[model samples]
Target chain A: MTREEVAARVVGVTAQQFAMKTSDIKESDQFTVDLGADSLKSIELVAAYEEAFGLSVKEEEALKVQDVGGAIDFFFRLLQ
Target chain B: MKPYELQDVPTPNLLEDTFPYSLPPLIKFEGKIKETIDGKEVEFDPNEVRTRDIHITDTTFRDGQQARPPYKREHMVTLFEMMSRLGGPKGVIRQSEFFLYTKNDRDTIDACRALNLKYPEITGWIRANKGDFRLVKEMGLKETGMLTSSSDYHIFHKQKQTRKEAMQQYIEVVEAAFEAGVRPRCHLEDITRADLPGFVFPFVQKLERLSEQVPQHMKVKIRLCDTMGFGLSYPNAAEPRSIPKMIWRLRNECGVSADRLEWHGHNDFHKVHINGASSWIYGLNALNGTLFGFGERTGNPPLEGAVIEYVALKGGLNGVNLPVITEMAEYYERVIGTTLASNYPFVGKDFNTTRAGIHAGGLRKFEQIYNIFDTTALLNRPPRVAITDKSGTDGVALWVNDFLGLQGEERLTVMKVARIQRWVMDQYEKEGRMSSITDQEMEEQVKTCLPEYYQAHRKN
Candidate 1:
């Protein structure tokens, strides 16, 4: 869909994966540093996004996304 | 030192010259190996191995049985047949020696002889007694290895005879073997720790002299036994312990030809395999070994290792059948009820199994990264990923795809197997599991996560 739609869904998946409230999750938050996602958690977060968006993502490229905003941008391009 | 710069090429240089990936890495050599003996520098052409008929002889029944409970008669017969196939038509594995002490042993020899394979002509082992010649003559074995311990330790302490007495006693046995119309292979026990010039050389020279009087097939053969694993393969390593100088003296000084010479080693110092291989490069024709390095004490040089070494040196398998190594391992585990260490090279359960996530990733992209040569092609064992908490998604994907028999583009990716990977991690992370996930457990996960693929593939 749109970048805003992607960002909203990415933020929801990120919050659910980290066990944080959706309102507390920020666009600038880095997955590991700010949200406390480990390597496996980061992979789990990508899997969550794939399930929520109903689309497949390139594993290497998707895993490279560092933050909520980066995840949004990655999915936005894949969807286009 | 000369200045150097990196080429920084676009693609990786895989160095296929040494690591052809289809076979064991080739051992390329340059120039000659030189050693100082009696104030003279002697040069040995290491490259002679390529042209020489370097081969393996087995003592699995003789020395291999010494370390473990005696193998049943049927076990020996089955193993002998497998050994013949393992060494193949050219007889890379030439002769297998047996003990003639028991009726069962002689019966096993008779049974193996019935197979009538051309290579690994069944031979016998005995103490250096003229009396033992009766057993060899009775068995109809063309060649037999007789104990002729050479060191002062063996001569004075063990045999309780002076060097002259021991040498003369050994000569009498060789003469007896000739009279019996059997070739005698003199196993110079503890030669690595022996006084080579005084005892070993004089004795071998006498044996060589005696060999001249007999027909070519009946000539005496010499086995340099590093009985205590004291032999060193290093260049210029001193005296009796140096394999090169020891072999060099026997070949050049004592007038023993390479064909009639064999190197038998023990693994007391873990130098058995290398010392045996070094003897071949230093110009001996035969490496006497036992299966899986099972022999007296720390065992002998592993015959399977020697087979791989032979291929690497010759740069080809010649006539060797590599898959029989796996068969032998299975036979040892399943029939013989003995399990090799999981990490034993080439033939163990975990020999080609990778556990690291990064390694699994590399293996998924290119198998050569984590595997040594092509185990699938050579040993009938493909590279495997053992699933653990640290195995990550790549490991799960590899395991699942291998389980499902998927390949190339059809192979499931890490993302596709994310749910199974999560379950695998949760085994240790959530359930506090401490053991690796078993193949049976992984099969359950495949049936759960990818039921469609499982149903489609395993429907029959």
Candidate 2:
């Protein structure tokens, strides 16, 4: 999948997990600071991304993704 | 202040020398321990325990039975058989004393003897009466412990005899044991509360003299019974409560060898196990204890605790079968209808179970971080997580993985068990549940939430 498609999917999952709109979610928005996602929620978001993309990401590495842009880049690299 | 800096090495140092996961933590000692005895400084070499034949003797039938209802003939027989295995062929648990008074006790002894497994050679406990000598002779037992109360409290108030009179009466019983070809173990009842220089020393010296006349197998053994749990393991803690000075006086002054001396303690002050372990370091060979510390009053030093201490000091199992401890606990609960406290070390229901979220996280990452030793390999009990409101997603993952018997990369992650964790939280927050989530409830939740993993991994 293209980086645009991965970013769009990442934004869609984040918005759905936090009960926000896709328009409100930004690539630069931090998961914890801007989106109000707690530790468990961040884990849930990663799980959601794994399910949507049909890929298993290592927990330690996946949890390191801080912002929407990072999650997008992380899944893009895994998809390649 | 000493100059010190954090080296910050690339690798973490877990100090495997002290915390080897395969065995109980090693008990390393440095330098000599000195205590003032009768205005003179006496030194005790703590390192002597490494080579000494330090072992455990049991009073589970005599003292342990005193605290609880009597075990049936079958229960005693079963427990005795398990004790033989727990101690193993090396006989880390050397002898177990049984009451020879009752017909039931004698029958139980016979049943235990029928098993004929060596190690934990059976001995008898009797009152210091010349007539009791017949019981020892009749049972064909080689060694017997006789009550030789030493404290003025016991001598005057309890026994209603003067120190000299009590000592003479006890001597007659010891002489009878000698004539009957049985070695006498003088249980110095309440010695920690007795006047050491006044009565205990003189009496032990006389007994040592008497032992010299008998054959090597028939020599009198002295059991320093801290009956009131007044014994202290602290350095220079004053007599007759100081365990070090007491053992020193008996060994150095009274001429009793280390092998002939035993330490028996009570748990009134919660120092029974340590006091018994300290006696070995202070140079005694045997630590007399009861199973699970069950005895008169606050109980005796726990025999299982002493077993673990032996492994720690010896730095090896030495053929001790630790899994039998779990089996014994199960037998006690199932057959005997007894319940041990949930928090009791080694055998209790929740002994290794963690309820905290952070601890569960550490346990899931690497079990050794939260577990004491390798409980799975040693005691047949793996580290577990008890589900509660405080147990977060990590705890849920741990419970599920352990319940399903999953290992290695097959274990589920916290994210995978998040739905159950949310359910657990909802029980307390949304439903006002006050109790811990039971394993059955957790199992049902696992089936409902993680259906695929549960279906694939569940052991029928």
- Residue B175 CA displacement from its true place in model 2, Å: 0.8
B284-313 per-residue lDDT for model 1 (tens digits): 999999889999999999999999999999
**lDDT tens readout by residue for model 2, B125-173:** 9999999888888999998999999999999999999988999999999
Residue B56 deviation, candidate 1, in Å?
0.1
- Give lDDT: candidate 1, residue B245: 90
* Candidates, DockQ: 0.51, 0.60
Model 1 stretches astray by more than 4 angstroms: B458-460
TM-score, chain B, each candidate? 0.98, 0.99
Tens-digit per-residue lDDT, A37-75, candidate 2: 877788888889989999877888998999999999999
Candidate 1, CAPRI quality class derived from DockQ = medium
- What TM-score do all the candidates reach, one by one? 0.96, 0.98
